[model samples]
Target: MQIDLLRRKIGLNFNDGFAEVWLWAPNANKVNICIQKTEHRLDMLAKEYGYWYLKTEQIRPFDAYSFELESNTDADNAKLKRADPASIYQHDGIFGDSTAFDLGRFEWTDQNWKPIAVKDYIIYEIHTGTFTPEGDFESVINKLDYLLELGITAIEIMPVSQFSGNRNWGYDGVFPFAVQNTYGGPQQLQKLVNACHNKGLAVILDVVYNHVGPEGNYFNDFGAYFTEKYNTPWGNAINFDDAYCDGVRTFFIENALMWFRDFHIDALRLDAVHAIKDFSPKHILAELKQHVDKLATENNRPYHLMVELDLNDNRYINSQQQGGYGMDAQWIDEFHHTLRVAAGQEKTGYYADFNGIEDLAKAYNDAYVYNGQYSEHRKKKFGVETENPGEQFIVFSQNHDHVGNRMLGERTSTLVSFEMLKVMAGAVLCAPYLPLIFMGEEWAETNPFQFFISHSDEELVEAVRKGRKAEFSAFHIEGEAPDPQDEATFNRSKLDWNKAATGMHKTMLAYYKTLIRLRKENAAFNDLNRKNTQARAITDKNTLFLTRSSEEQIIICLLNFSKNQQNLQLNLPGNMSILLNSATTEFGGPQPTANAIQHNGEISIAPESILIFSN
Candidate 1:
């Protein structure tokens, strides 16, 4: 009998002189456990139903060990295998020997690093593969200085989990416990995080808990890790509340802890959390939050968990004290839609539902368009109103998914006017919610973020392309979706780093730098309290005027969404100084005689632009 002797549930409890190891083997009547270093062999004593435990005086790091199992009928029908699930340094894939890795091996220099508060975050999202031509964790470390120079507090990297092949966006991760060998594995990730911390930049890892990739998935061989009861877009949902769910939940929770404890990542950004179906008393998200919070408290380090959810449910971001799942923040897509529509640059798809200044105002004021109201897009009532502070929401004009999902993968820079781009940037960066900038948005990299994938299976590749086309056909987008499996698609998405030193890219980078600097230095922009931030539309026109005040200063943001410049009357309380202007000729705007105009009570508004005035 070729029994795959994969250890399903293995627990190791250690002390100074001795260690206790427990495992589950339903078909096994007799088990032989061997410790590599001490060469101690033990006949496991049955602790309970189909359970075995061994208490011995052997403890060493990187201790190679295996378990041999035998059935009641025959002694020759036994198999030996590794124990631990997360064997950091795997030699020959999943079936290899389990090597005990000491978490204290790496000497971390980030002793003073504290996680940036979610409310004060300005995130810069990057894909390790396309972020730089080198395409590795070390390459990202080399670029940390650039991110820090741009005033980004956190660097949210796309998933780095081990997948089937080398190059992938990491959403199709299979070995949730293993780091991608292409991206230099677990040690490289640790080095990246340590390097990021050394530069005062917090690291936020994007993790997919919705579904594992089809290939290299061996969870089923171990136990009932997934459920056929609930289904997701990808496939079967994880068994979060089923019979063997405790172990499954522990697997993910341990993975989270591995990233935090072993890799020293400051935060985790849960990807597509709405798809995590769990109909139990304790939802996986809630339980995970509790565990994370406890870990944070014990370590005396600031740990955060952000969620990417489309449910528009305020409960996701609400405080646990309010009978809600405690998440640090959530990505707000309405903010992007409203700003995009208000700027009059509506692309195909979701833009059809949002095309007015009211939407932008609602997005600004309430942080969501649904807010328990009827949504024409979904054709139903959606989203609960958020009573929490606005900073709990993360807003962005563009992201990897938004740009990459397009048929041609055109970015906002390709669709909107140069002036409008600045306006959108200003609106996003100055909003009460935390701002997230896509990889090259600071410099407006011309390269489109085309969707790309490397699937080993040919049939799945065809299905992916067809599925993409079917998705966009409903929205009436021109042309079929590009084949992600095509190498050209991935190649085209690489950022042209040289562009940052030239024309539009240079201008956009400067604009972003100035805006970020002002945001950091200004007390008004730092204010997270919604009561201090008030936004009022300039009449029923497509213009918005927002005032943000704190104890130290008062700032007002003026945005004009029209194509042509229109003279408008303004109401001001006191003298105002032009702190920042997105329409300056320096940022790909038309040359203007006046750059900074001090006004007593009024100001001239520029077309398709944003102006910040402070007192």
Candidate 2:
């Protein structure tokens, strides 16, 4: 099978009391294994298909090693050498030597764990660098209990692949297989995933398969891994369908399988899948899904493959028999745009296409606003309407890109009032699509999630600082874009975990926890049947009404987006009682009167609040 043949014998593998090292250097005439921090040297014999192989008993676990190659096609063949392209762990830094680490042994406690369905998952997205004060893997493990108490079913950690320096957003990963050395390396990440599984929570890792980072990338030195034919937002695009593309496809496919077969993760959120340019008959995504589903069946576990795309295309989430990619779900960013504009955020760039109320309604009623319609922003006819179920779309109000892309990466609480914050949360928790909450959003953290990076190259650092400031000219707000290389920028983004116990922050946390509980335990909230849900907007009053029902019960959510109070007499259902009131005094608001006020079909909604009633 292709999955088994991908990662086999590519790196340092130990078997039968000997270390077998294999390297795929098609252009090299000679290869040598240099044991760093030691004086041992070994020569490799060239095998079929230009593969260099060597077996030695001198190597031990955690031994640092590198390769020395000689080839006339290489630019610096006699000058310097590169680290293993398939390194699973790196020591010192990304530029350091690869280590011989074994994945055969770990005290994993999640033997009977299985993943939850995509329609039932409440994924909480997180960035390890800014999630805690220490910015490491163990720190995140310390707070898994807090997530469990909040009724979260899964945790979607951002990328942790090895990057240059110490700080990054994980999109600029240089080493595809190696875990980030600074983030406690491979074993530490294993511990975190195992802990999450033991807590009855699934783990989804975000993987970047687009353009490689600018520095410390050496795949081009061996063969045609990149192409200059196509231009992306980043520089050269990866050569997925070009000459010698078989190896390139195998490289990324192996990376995806390693996370499932080796790391024991439940899912993978592929980053910027639109940037992955390919024209082959069997697309890389289709191949990946096929392999993953087979692996999941063999292991008797649940697994999903989700994608992030700007194309607004249904083919990514549709079934394979329909001539689609067969991905499990997609990150529907239009929900975030609609919610932001509805709550009065800046309307510039792509936000100009959305007008809040109508678009937000489209997001609930239909999966896309631009389906079979002309986009004024793109100045072209875009998107085809599809019968793809709403459960295949993942929606959120705020995420890393929506927040950190701003001049100041301010949270929604910084842009809107506390009551409106609850309003947005209600829209997501009670909607038909899957929901994901960014880290520090539950209690409305006051800190900003600004973009930050640490690069050793002085020239590259200056270019990034200049590029970020220039990119924000299209948005409102003045001044500089905050130097991403500055240590203070990263420091300002760390969450104040202690704030969840006091004042308004504490109240918001309680409100979120309550909403999550309803999503989990209540049948009216989580039934995936489309006929059970309906939404409408009262444009004149700036109010939205949503209903979700089961055979036994019915639930309604009312959200007011205006600053003035609204009193209305409307025909509601029978036997109504309050389930969650965002304006309650317990949640740091004015203690409203008795919540059951539907007598004679009359009720008054407070300004900027959310009221959920069940019948």
Candidate 3:
């Protein structure tokens, strides 16, 4: 029997007095829609493909409802009241009644909005809860100009989907369609997207489609949403290839489309694609791309799907014609890891696999440093070698995982010197890939982004605590990991916006602004073609010389990783003039060299600094 996954719209679609509800439950003998406000129950007609649907003029928009599913095997024929798995709004909680929302009612002012190109994107990744003190969508709206002033092209928000509790890293999100009620619900999110589009800032939403979170997870009671055939770090993997898996795939695929079609989201950053286990002839990601491409063609605007994948396999970003997943771009963890190692991160755990300077150089040349190489961390040969375009990779110095996963959750600012911080920023911005900055990274905010969650289950809380500690046991960090359930942990993670305007923080902010400006305005730096880039690591002096060139202009970037000043010479054709120097007095660094053209292609670089010379 063939199941048409997109045959009918799931969830409650409500008008003024008309509503159509659809639920997927193959195991249910009967299903009923129970309206919470009027206490009215209506029996749904069981249609083909295991779907129960009801079309009535009784329910209106904003009405809260729950599904009643009666199993045939139950001797009592008891019907269980469960929140709609396809809920758009869950006002009360994740386990409470689902609210029917009129998504078309929002007045959008971004009809003429144009999306930023993927190659030129300078992304500012933000955690909604901690990005502002108010911890909501409206509060973020207040800081739009601030972000624009910082020169980021796009704002990549961390997951805003409804999670177990008010506070989470958002990986624990269960309801894929429901916007977090604590974060002002679905309408607020619509407003945020609309505002971003109007401001010429593309919004990239991070979505988790791996294993669903444990708390409030009622998928088992409804249908076959998970399978024992595969397991993720979270638990049993989402059913993507098992029997009745088409419905599960369709549910998530529709969720992705809803973000773009309804909310006007510019792009979606698919979280951790490596964990998504699917062995179907046409993989789930490929199927999603096929659908997204179809919508993009109709909308007449480019929509993108960037993925967070640790797997160095380029198949995810390769085009569908080449038998690949067809993702627009992917987060390159190798770039982050190798750069961190070169910047003096402790060579332990995953870092043990990277050998600093050489590896960083390799990452700059090839997208993956460990391509087809034996990895000490994994104890196996990892990552196939492939030629992927530079624009297809998203590079960053320090993101949430880098800082938050640590025992104390220390930012790069807390871990490295101020001069080295400049070097780190230059390394990422100067690369031929798109750059992403974590929230508060520009001004070097010192707040620890420690892991925090508010799961209502005490046993689950304890398990998380124990699991966190066990995960860090190999790192050899002393003291217990911070209590993830504690409110203090979440509070401690909030950004201090005031720091961006004061003292060294202000200077760092200026430095970041300059770097971003150069990245956007400079001809050579703006070109993302890997064929026009060259990176060579000087091991003895601990320096890297990177050359980027456009058809008309060329620039040579010198980065010194050592703490000592080093004199170096690049044997290039023409005389080079200093474009930007991180060690200049204007950027809060000691002026170690007079600004002049290197006629002989020789110059002295300051300790832990970056210098750009253009011909």
Q: How close is every model to the real structure, measured as TM-score?
A: 0.88, 0.96, 0.97
* 408-491 per-residue lDDT for model 2 (tens digits): 888888989888898888888888888999998999888999998998989999988888888877775588787888989999
Give lDDT tens digits, candidate 1, residues 283-350. Answer: 88888888787777778887788999898887787877887788888998877877877877554577
Candidate ranking under lDDT, highest first, comes to 3, 2, 1
Q: Candidate 1: minimum summed lDDT over ten consecutive residues — where? A: 1-10
Candidates in descending TM-score order: 3, 2, 1
Q: For candidate 1, what is the lDDT?
A: 0.77
Best candidate, TM-score: 3
Each model's C-alpha lDDT? 0.77, 0.83, 0.89
Candidate 3 Cα misplacement greater than 4 A, ranges? 1-8, 15-17, 572-574, 592-600
Off by over 4 Å in 1: 1-101, 593-602
Reference-based TM-score, model 1:
0.88
Tens digits of lDDT, candidate 3, 1-615: 222233227777764467877788988988989999899999999888788888898788888889889998778888899998889899988988999888778999999897788887899999999999999999999999999999988999999889988999888888888999999999999999888888889999999999788899999888899999998999899999999998888888888888888888989999999999999999999999988888888789889999999898989999999889999999998888888989999988888898888988888888788789898899899997767788899999999998999988999999999999999999999999999999999999999999999999999999999999998978898899999999999999999989999999999999999999988888898888888888999999999989999998898888999999888876666566777899888888998453733546667788999988788
